[model samples]
Target: MTIMQEITTDSDQRQPIITLQGITRSFGPVQALRGISLALKPGRALALVGESGCGKTSCARIIARMDRPSTGDLYFRGRQFTSSQSSEDEKTYRRAVQMVFQDPFAALNPVFTVAHHLARPMLLHGHAKTRSEVAARVAALLASVDLEGQSTAGKFPHELSGGQRQRVNIARALAVEPDVLVADEPTSMLDVSIRLGILELLSEIKRQRNLALLYITHDIATAAHVAEEMIVMFAGQMIEWGDTRTIIAEARHPYTRLLLSAVPDPDRPFVPGESVEFLRHAEAIRKVSRDASAAIEQIGPNHFTRSVTL
Candidate 1:
């Protein structure tokens, strides 16, 4: 099948800046995304957490227009179009939404200065005027990402630390003044100590600029750190999702609990005479979660868990 045939539908909504309905992708035999659906509202973030190959990056690429789904409804802003969009339309859609990938180190070229990277996006999207205008805008972008324009704009990506490079990536995404930001494993590549700094920057952007953000990661702990709402994915399907606090406190699905249980505890809990019997049960739960046909059931306000049979 061609690219357009891969993604099923185009159903936009007026309320959401971006929406995905029944999004499912298959690599011939392997289903990458199993009818995944989520909406990104302006000024809020939804954390998509899952193990690698659990469809987080696939979802990111689909939303970024870099990849397409096998069968699903995609919406921009209250409009409906055929899944097979013209090249021009695709370009337009990409300009409205942008992505920050996991490896900030690899996302940029070693030779290009920070100015060159940020300036290109601004010029490509017509966010800047002449070279001088591009310079000014690039500086502003650097500042927005909490980097020093004077020092950063002149430095190459390699000269910057992982945190700084990620900042530059975020700034480059904002260079186009996009409504949606898709961050896939954004902080996983950075030093653990600096991860919070990057998360804080994203939060500040959402609050100040009213940008909708999608934070895709495997780290559930950090999901609560950045996103107000969360969706936990396993085996290419959502297992548990709801308010960040609610999902954390009232986890129902075996996968969700297992994930939470896997979180390294500084003060590890001791089980009373239960020498990991729950672990065998946990492995069984994972095996069951590997199936993609589980139904979804709402357990609380905006909280949902996968209904796995057998």
Candidate 2:
């Protein structure tokens, strides 16, 4: 689907809610991200697509304040707030921007009951006071995630299904009333059928709360379900980005085309080996796409590409 500008109003087009300008990251000799630019509009989801180790996770980490960008300007609500952030500022940022990690099972504490898990964030962020208020809010949080209040409150992480644990993670992220939500490979660990439920819940929460979202995943096919805009990254650099519909319909970047070609088609059953072949070739594409290039070609409205020259 296309970016719903009609639904999300830009604040006089002065700035995006979250903006990363020329982001770059390096780990010793390895370059994790390369001059990447992205934005998260309020009340809309922006999907960052790439293969494993393509820097999608690194980008998510930077946005969540878990890691600092080696070179880039991160602007929150039009103000520059990079790694130099003060302790108080960092605390506020943590409350404003929350993250939902990939492994649902590992995210929550097995020893803690659901109530304790939910209470900590609400208490830490000063969202609720008194044990009575905390208990009340925990129940509400569980309900927000579509879990039955009474039953889910006492269950531990191990007691719930993969999908249930993920829902709790989402609820915890929401407990702080954050402005930006970053989810990294959130549905990859869930059953295929259950993934859609989580995606729908996220969409519902976004609309209801008007929270800007950064949805990071390797599955390009799933981007259309949650994100209105899209960015296709190859070897840590963004090669193509624009409206989701445009990218899926008219993918220009060779890497982007390679990704879409591998997605399963509903009209016909795909041969088992086809996707495997595409995945096997992914590394070859990244090896060549990693070359830092100064040139960028605008293919269409909100569509651009940085094709590697042979």
Best by TM-score: 1
For 211-240, candidate 2 gives per-residue lDDT tens digits of 888898999888978988888887788878
Worst 10 residues of 1 by lDDT: 1-10
Off by over 4 Å in 2: 1-14, 266-288, 308-310
lDDT of 1: 0.81
Give one clash count per candidate, in the order shown. 2, 0
Root-mean-square deviation of each candidate, in angstroms?
5.0, 4.4
Q: For candidate 1, lDDT tens digit of each residue in 1-310?
A: 2222222112322267777877899998998888777778888888999888798999898889888788888888856532867888777888889999999989999999999999888887788889888888888888899899998998998899999999999999999888899999988889889999999999999889888899998988889889978889987887777677888877777777777777775475222223356666876888999876666676765677778753
Clashing pairs in 2: none
